[model samples]
Target: MEKNQKPLLIILAFFSIYVIWGSTYLLNKIAVNELPPFMLAATRFTVAGILIFIIAMMMGKSIAISWRQLKNTIIAGFLFLSFGNGVVVWALRFVDSGFAALEVSAQPLIVLVLMRILQGKKIQLMSIVGVILGLIGIYLLVSQKQILSQENSILGMSMIFLCMLSWAYGSIFVGKADLPRNHFVNTGYQMLMAGIMLAISSLLFNETWSSPWVWSSPVQLSVLLLIVFGSIVAFTSFNYLLKVVSPEKVATSTYVNPIIALVLGWYFLEEEVTLQSIMAAVVLLTGVYFINTKRKFMVFTRFFRS
Candidate 1:
């Protein structure tokens, strides 16, 4: 069992990030029908953060951090949550959904370049191919709409670019920076800090809802799912993966999420999965496979050449 532990953990981490996080898009879509975006995110993360903090304490994980560490965590929270997620949330108001998906799909590529440039990490050729393939697959998967022809289209695209950069930088920073050794503790602090910032922003902009927040079944269920799956499980898994694997590899979850999201749509919503969608999924997964499985893939290459 011990021998199988590391691979098992890696699989679990990937599953958490790829599937659970992808599912949140549907949840958020359903949720935004009732709640305003920033407030929804604020509530989700705040609640999730508190719950994770409590859980960490129960597990004997120390919740303490130095002032400097707290500062670092807050910066990460801003980058990953406040800017990365918040900007995307804001842009969705102006950007076409397909265009937004295309821009967001560039995250792995952004991370790849950032990792190479900022951290001076070397990327493998296969990984580059995989990221490109993933991007092409994503472009095919979504509607082929002209992105920048509308009013404020440039602004929307710029915000999404910032979103990708902030998220990529945050992932890299967390791996290098000294934070809470406990994953849950670190994530809890980060989420709480980001949630607070987003909530403040929402109020500063005078964002309002038509009704007082009521706990209808769908709203309650969406919030619960976001807390459990998105914040607690997927975010912690992301942090853990950043520690264990290359940040580029960790960022491959960007590509995987859309694939899982499409599958969920097909399964739950009875959405059509066209032949193009299937081909895109294959190309995307193939790219991801080559990118992450470098060593084993090298062996396969050698065998084929022989």
Candidate 2:
């Protein structure tokens, strides 16, 4: 943890949350095509949770938590993984993964607005501009005739939007909530609780289960990647970054995730990359940049006033 190494580690952590996490949309899209959504999600997380515990113990980390921490972890888990991630997985059944990622790029805007309402923080001029651009980008993306005309696309898009709210609020909550000191233990608890709930949800919805052995080669590989990198590595980075940086800074993963998803979807799955989508991605990520910019706005304002 030397000063030089810390910055490098932070950069590497950002890389994990950015590039690895960005690839998960395409991964989930592939896996969901062959498996039931909730069932797929249940299996991925349940196994990942178990693996996390095993790894944490092997590393000589204590996984103990008080009841209050357990309860809060469950709440955060449901908000982040169960509803936020699971519904997005479900929605991928209808919409293309790249398109879904494009829509989700507005996460910073949602987070910014939530901070304003919940914390009584005023939206600064830069963030206000970001919000306006985010809205325009979202409207352009979702309002496309081609997208809206697809069966269940609207439903899928609507559910994903709700999931974004859950994720945004969860981001805000986890930054301030009492939780386990070890990021590994905290994430392990969250994943375990979230997985159990997702398993119950899958059963309640009557989704059929199948053995991973019978899954297609591509899907099996995708699930393995989702479990190893997406759930364990990337999410751990996410939890760590939440502690080390601003929540909105951690959320900047949304900025790069869509681009990675778009290229992977188009190259691997032959998913369409429409012109409108590209335009929307540009506007959306630009707004995300504006929202994350820290102090230059105030400096510029002061200069103008002077």
Candidate 3:
């Protein structure tokens, strides 16, 4: 890509991440109406993993890994996709998809605190404040009268929050591990592991797939979107963006995703957008923004002290 084209590609890639991933929440919700959450996620990831893995192989990316790498990836994959994504998909049966996304937006704060506790990383006062604000925002969201009135919303939201923590822990673990050389190939392996885990979970939960269970055209379309756009295209765009743009800039997708999810939920799914949810979204995203701003703040502080 030329210099002039690079900027446009970045913009387009960012758009893909923002729009495609945001839409997945609603699509997952739609698909889960007919399919069990674990089954739905398992099928989606299995197809995506195989397709992407084959593409990577064709492109000359090695798909082999050491035993230790495989073990670590299995652990990370269970945490990231089996719990992180699988639980979110299940929770959608009880709460709006946008609401689940809001809970996920709190992940950075949880990751910050986890890093402090597990890795003995320093907890700056600002990071602590971010965590606290994020907690309060989550409290406000879950304790909302609207969620309280709904059946199993509280349980669903709690599951989503737990899922976020799982994802954060997995992310930190993956960062510290020696994984495969290529990110795309590593992701394919991770998705494959997640698919296996989710499949086992579905069987353990006794989710039956009978002949009466029909996949409507909408459901089929939704699954296609999840596999193709959400998993493949958005992830490809994000990986590309990480090379071209600053990591912090790419991280803006954290805050952007929830709002986009909320809008799509309301417009497409007719999910309610309560004042409390909007308020919570503002507070939660603000907390995430602060959590992500740590490096910039540290640099500024050091400059002043010097």
Instruction: Give the TM-scores of the predictions, in the order they appear.
Output: 0.80, 0.94, 0.86
Query: For residue 140, what is the lDDT in candidate 2?
Result: 86
The lDDT, on a scale of 0 to 1, for candidate 1 is 0.74
lDDT of each candidate versus the true structure:
0.74, 0.89, 0.79
In TM-score terms, candidate 1 sits at 0.80
**Candidate 2 residue-wise lDDT, 105-143, digit = tens:** 899999999999999988888888888899989988998
Q: Candidate 3 lDDT (Cα, whole model)?
A: 0.79
Residue pairs in collision within model 3: none
lDDT tens readout by residue for model 1, 220-296 = 88788888988899999888778766676677676667666666656765655567656666765676665665674
User: In model 1, what lDDT does residue 22 have?
Assistant: 77
Candidate 1 — which pairs collide? none
Query: Between 1 and 2, whose TM-score is larger?
Result: 2
Pairs of residues clashing in candidate 2: none
Cα lDDT tens digits, model 3, 1-306, are 224435556777788877788889999999898899898988888888899899998999889999998998789778878888999999999999888878777877777778778989887776667777888898888888888889988788888878878877776676567767576777788789889999899999988653323688889889988888888778666655544443434556778788888998899889999898888888888877777666654442231121
Give the CA lDDT, 0 to 100, for residue 99 in model 3: 87
**Highest-TM-score candidate:** 2
